[model samples]
Structure formats: C-alpha cells, structure tokens
Target chain A: MKVVCIGAGNVATHLSQALYKAGFVITQIVSRTEENAKALALSVDADWTTNPDNIEDADIYIYSVSDSALGEMIHRNPRKNGLHVHTAGSMSLSLFEGYKERGGVLYPLQTFSKGKAVNFKDIPLFIEASNADDLNVLRELASGISNKVYEASSAQRQQLHLAAVFACNFTNHLFAIAESILHEADIPFEVLRPLIQETIDKTATLSPREGQTGPAVRKDFNVMNKHLDKLTDHPEWQEIYRLLSQDIINNHRG
Target chain B: MKVVCIGAGNVATHLSQALYKAGFVITQIVSRTEENAKALALSVDADWTTNPDNIEDADIYIYSVSDSALGEMIHRNPRKNGLHVHTAGSMSLSLFEGYKERGGVLYPLQTFSKGKAVNFKDIPLFIEASNADDLNVLRELASGISNKVYEASSAQRQQLHLAAVFACNFTNHLFAIAESILHEADIPFEVLRPLIQETIDKTATLSPREGQTGPAVRKDFNVMNKHLDKLTDHPEWQEIYRLLSQDIINNHRG
Candidate 1:
C-alpha cells in the first residue's frame, strides 16, 4: 500500500521507517519543515513536500503529528478516498469526520527518542476504526509492523497513555532526579545503573507490589526522616519523597 | 577468610552465598529467628545460631541487619579482635566504634529481593574502613566478588542510599501505580513492559534529561488536564501527577 506520513518528528520518523521496512511503499513525506521532510523522505526513498496542497494521492495517509496540530493537519489534508489514520494516543477517531468511513487510529504504545531505534515488532500497537472494513485494514497493516496489536477504543487508549506517563515518562523524570542527587554528592550515576536495571528486571518474575523494597515499604521513619533532611535544599523533591513514601506505606498497610 | 553473617534477610542471604562462592568460608549464620538462620546456614554449609552468646569466632563479622537493629546487634556481638563491617548503605562506619581498628562497611548498591539472583560481579560495592589495613582487607574482599568497587565515605554512602530510594524503590512504586491504573482500565500490564524496557535502555545512550518526552515537557495543558480528569478518583495520584508534572515543567523552563 502507498503510505504518506504527515509529520517528521520522532514518532513520525520511527513509524514511517518501520512501515517502509514492512513492505509498504511510502509515497511522500509531508511535514511543516522542508529540512526534516527531505531528510526523512530521502531515507524512505519518497518525495518530500511542505505544502498540504502538494500532498500526493496514496492508499493511506498516516497523521503522526502532535496532539495540538493533528486536527488542523487533518482539516488541511482532506482526502476522502483513502484511509485516514492518526498515531496519537489521546485523539479520538472523530478527528477524521470528513472522511468518516476511512478514519482510524494506529497508536504505538511506546516512547520514541530521536536517534533511538526500537524494534517495531515488540511495540504494542493500539488500533481503532469507524467500521469493520477499515478496522480489518488497520489490523492487517498493524500486524504487518508489530506482533502485538489490539483494538482499543479512544477512551482506553487515553487511559493507556496516562498509565504510560506514569510507567515511562514520569519514571524517567525520577531517574533524572536521582541523577541530580548523585551529582550533588559527587557520586557517579554509573553506580546506580545496575540497581536501576534490577528494579526493572524484577517485574518479569514478580509483580511490582511483590517486588517492592527499601525504607518506604519497611516504614523506617528514621531513614525516611534522614532522607527528607538530606533533601531540605530541594523542597519539591522532599515533597515528592514524602508523598511517594506515604503512598507506598498506605498501599502495603494491613 | 572465615566470615560470620548476622541477620538472615535478603542482603545477608545473598552476601553470605556470594562470599561462600568466592571461597570465603561462612562460619556461621546468626539471626534472631531459628528457621531463617538454619535455612541460610544449610545453603552455605555453615552452622546456625540464634543466640548472640553462641556466635562463632571468625576473621570477619558482617552485620546485614536492619538499620534499627544494627546498633544493638553490634552491642550484642562484641568481638573486639575480629574485623567488623556492615552491608547497609545509610549506616555509618562508626556503628563499629567498639572495634575501632577493624570496623568497616561493604554496602552493595542494588535492590535485593527474595529469590532474585543478581550478578554480583556487576553490582557496585561501596566499602569504607577506619584503618588502612582493614580498608585493604575490605578492598580485597569486595573486589573478589564485584568488578565495580569504590571506597565511599559514610556520608557519601548515605547519599547514595538516598539516591537509590528515588531511583529504585520509588521507581518501582511508580510501576505499581501504572499497574493499578491499567487494572482500572481493564488493560493488561504486559503492554507496558516494552515501553518500560525502552525507557531504561534509553539511559545508556541519552541522559535522563535529554531523553525526556511527554506532555509535561511540552507543557500541553489540554492533555494534562484531560489526564487529571481521568485521575479524579485518585486524589493522591492526582497530587503526585501534578507535582511531578510541575517539576518537569520547571526543570525544562529555559
């Protein structure tokens, strides 16, 4: 199938490359920036265009733009003949109301970094469509790129994205906090890498609740107080520490 | 060298086994409970003792007890002649003040769970000693099991422990939070596994700050408000989400 990607950002770059590798012919790369569009189009062996009016006819137009720009982009590139799908977790299928028969979603439930190359097969792709025919087409296209594909409504995808913010994005911010803590103490962040890795690895064998350890779970107020004292200079972090500890204590309480 | 391990919890169990494998003879397993002491002793082919008075004389004594019990455990096992140390990150080397010449620390910077087998070679072992001779002994003993060994002061080790609480313990709690969120949405936790793994793997290539991506970083209030609405039932989580998102915004503000 001929595919045209609507953005050249992280998600678009990764998704378009994955789709191209999955035997789909990327006909054009339509992005706001000529530089990014040309770079991505060159990599995928497709034509690049910045004007929405210059968008080529394709079997699929995948809108991989940001949440704020998705609606406007859809309105600008109103194509009624092809399948119009978005790659957003929070957006509804109604965004393609003009092409109601072809509107769909192909949200990959994973965080994408600029230079990172993730294995598309392992990512869980959540798909939604307005009708059975479009849903089937999405199922086949999604299964072509990923082994784990699920049909989720827009509501479920939004919840999944929120859960992901906790699991992936917010969790990463915690790592950044840890990095800053270690930096203040002149301790190399490398020392905590193994511990961080083991924390994640434990999830394979035990549930997160079952694998919990450290001062918070033990209700060691002495240690917790000492840690809070250590973070006195950073009140925000202290609050985070206190709140998270209290939550852990509450969750484990009899 | 012969070693006597106090406490039969996760750290003591893992350390004693690692010492035994490294050719150090674990002479006895000492703890308050008879069953746990006996089980660990049997695994390491050592004698088990519940009574402090019956503790064996060994070249080195390693106290792997809780923070609250470490002081009393030191008082109970007063063997001024042998080398004494602890495996606690938050504890001070002064806990062994009675054995001033031989007191030291050998803290492994990692989270240990029951039955989870971690590669000791990769774990960072933080050691501290009052005297040069004892420090050399600790360095030798630590280097035997781990490729990553460093002499960290008591204060430095305490900070490392605090940092670890954020990086490992609290991070796992976030995963638990994510799990609960998915449960409420009727979504399986398995879908987040790949995303979680990728989040960690990104740390190897990009610093946590540079790798960060999400609505909080973008300051997308619309999506953030929508997520907050979704989390209306979870007041504590709502607070957490608000605080973390605010922190991310502040940190990224240019």
Candidate 2:
C-alpha cells in the first residue's frame, strides 16, 4: 500500500513512521515547511513536497494535521487520493465530505509528543469510514500497526475523543498541577511519580471509582480545607480543588 | 528495632508489612476489632490485640489511622518510650505533642489499597521529626524500605499531600469519567488503557505542561462545544468539562 502523509506534526510523524514500518510506502510527505517535511521524508525514505498540488498518486492520503489547521488544510487536500483518511479523534468524517464514497478516519487514541517514539501497536485505533471497503482498507492498515482497532461512528468517536481529554489530557493537567505544587514547595516532582504510577496501575485491576483515594473521594472536609488554604495563591488551582472534590463527593456519596 | 503498628487499615496494613519485610519486629498489632487486627498480625507474624492499652513497649509506635480519626486516636496513642510516628501526610508533626522529644512523621507518599502489595522500595517516604535523635531513628527505618527518602517539614509534607490529590486522586477521577463516557457508548474501557498509560509515561520524560495535548489547551471551542453537546444528559460532567477546559486554556495560554 502507498500513503501520502499530509502534515509533519507529532501525529503525522508518528503515524507516517508507523505506516512505513507496516510495509506501506509513503510516496510523498507534504508540509508547507521545508525542514519538517524534508526531515520526516528523509526518515521515512519518501519524496518531500512543499505543495499539496505536487502530492503523488497513492492508495491512501492521511491528513494528520492539527484540528485548528484542518480547515486551512482542507483546501490543500491532495487531489489524487485513492482513499482519504485523517488521524484526528475530534474531527468528523464529514471533513472529507466531497469524497464521501472514499474517505474515513483512522483516529489513534493516544498522545504523541515530538521526539518521543510511540509504540503504535499499543495505541487504540478507532476506524470510521463511509463504506465497508474504505473501512476495511483503513482497518487493514491500522491492524498492521496496532493490535487494537475498533469501528467507531463519528458520534461514538467524538464521545471517545471527549473521554480522551479526560483520560489523557485532563489527567495530564492534574499532573502539571502536581508538578507546580511541588515546585512551589521546593520538593522534587519525582516524589509523586511512584504514587502516580500506582494510581494508574490500579485501574488495570480495579474500577477507577473503586480505586479513588485522598480527601476528595472520602470528602474529608478537614484535609480539603487544609489543601484549599494551601492553594490560596493559586486561586485557579484552588477553584479546581473545590470543584473536583465536590464532584467526587457527589459521585461517591450519592 | 521493635515496633507497634496501631490500626489495620490500608496504610497500616501496607506499612506494617513493609516494616516486617525490613526486619522490624512488630511487637503487637492493635485495632478496635479482633478480626481486623489479628488478620494483619497473622500476616506480619505479630501478636494481635483489640486494645491500644496492650501496645507493647516497642522502640517505635506507628499510627496509620484516618485524618478525622487521628484526633480521637491521639488519646488512644500507644505509650511507648523510644519514638512515635504517624503516617498521615496532612497532619502537623505536632500531633505527637506529648511525646515531642521522641516523635515525628514518617509519611509514605503513596496511595495504599487493600489487598494490593505495594513495593515499598518504589514509594517515597517523607520523614519529619521534632528532634535530631528521633529523626535519625525514623530515617534509618524509612531508608531501609524505600530508596526515595527525604526529610520534609510539616508544611512541605502537607504541600506534597495536596499535590498527591491532584496527581493521583483527581487523575483517577478523570479516569473514572473516561470509563463512564465509554460505558455510555458501550465501548470497552480497555481501549483507553494505552492512552492512560502513555499519559503517565510521558510525565517520566517530559514535564506535564510540555506533555499536555488536547482541545482545551488549544482552546478549540468548536470541538469543546461538540463535546458539551454530546454530554447534555450529564450536566454535572458537563460543568466539570467546562471548568477544567477553561482552566487549561487559561493556564497554557497565559
């Protein structure tokens, strides 16, 4: 199979690399930036291009652009595509509306950071296509790189995207808050790592609700008040502490 | 060193087991119930008793009780001569007021769950003592079990505890929300395991701020609105989603 990856961001780099590893020939790497496109193209042994008009004929065109840039990219859509696919969890399949007969989504529900090597096989790929054939093609491509592939409708994928925000993004924000708090206290963030690892590890064996701990889950007002007082300088963090604690109480208590 | 562990809860169970593994002789296990104390005592090969009064003359007495119950427990505080410690992250070291000369806090900055075997060597142990002699004794014990041991003050330990709420408790709650959202869509929660693991694994290499990626950080109101629309039935979850997303935008954008 041949693919033309139409972005050079984290997702694009990782996705294209995974596809290349899966025996797919990335015919052309298209990005407005010369360096990023050429760099990834060199790594994947693909021809690099700065213009979408120069996109090579391929079996699949995967647009792994940012959600915000997706609109700006829609006009630059590669014309010679056998099948059009995007790797966005939030986006609808309608992004490829004009090519309704031969388009779909191969959304990988995992965070990809620049310079970080992602094990695609561990990522859960949510596949959505307009028809069975396109989906099967995407599924075949996804299955080559990943063990987890599921058929998710646009609505279901959207819900899954929201869940990803909570599971991956928001949980990460909490970790950032932890780093911030520890930074202020002159304590190393390393101290909390084991606790964080155990917290995540518990989920594989226990429900998150059942695995819940600390002041919030127990609704220990004393400890909660102490924590709130400590966050006086960080009013935004203080507000978060209050809201999440309240929600945990309502969920667990009720 | 001789020890008496008061309480048979998660913290107590894990702490006592760790102490036993470190070759400390747990002279007696004290709890309000025979079954509870005996169960833990049997595992640690120590005598069990339902009375705090029966707490032997051990070198150190570790109180691993709840935050609310700590005050009530101080009165039941085992009268020992060598040293006294509590495994609470929030409580002031002054809780060992009467034994001020020979008491401090030996807080393990990790979440303990029933039936889960935590490797103490992986957990961070925070030691705080009112005096140098008591400090060394506590440090000696803590260092034996945990590789990551630090002398943190009452205030610093309190901050660490609050940070753990964000890193562990709030993170786990977000996971619960993810599970709920997936449950509603009839999707298996296992699909999210990889995403969750990566979310955590990223923290090991990247700062949480740098690791963050989502619609919220990007301030993509279009996608956020779509998510809110999908969550119409879950107003509580919707409110949570809005607040957290807004906070993320403010923190990252500012």
Candidate No. with top DockQ: 1
What is every candidate's C-alpha DockQ against the true complex, given to 2 decimals?
0.87, 0.83
DockQ of structure 2 = 0.83
Give the lowest summed-lDDT range of ten residues in model 1 chain A.
A93-102
lDDT of candidate 1 at residue B35, scale 0 to 100:
97
Off by over 4 Å in 2: A78-81, B78-80
Candidate 2, residue A222: lDDT: 91
Candidate 1 backbone overlaps, count: 0
Residue B120 in model 2: lDDT: 92
For candidate 2, the per-residue lDDT at B219 reads 77
TM-score of each: 0.98, 0.96
Which candidate ranks first by TM-score, i.e. highest? Answer: 1
Q: Which regions of candidate 1 are displaced past 4 Å? A: A98-100
- The clash numbers for all candidates, in the given order, read 0, 0
Instruction: Indicate the worst ten consecutive residues by lDDT in candidate 1 chain B.
Output: B93-102
Interface RMSD of every predicted model, in angstroms: 0.8, 1.0
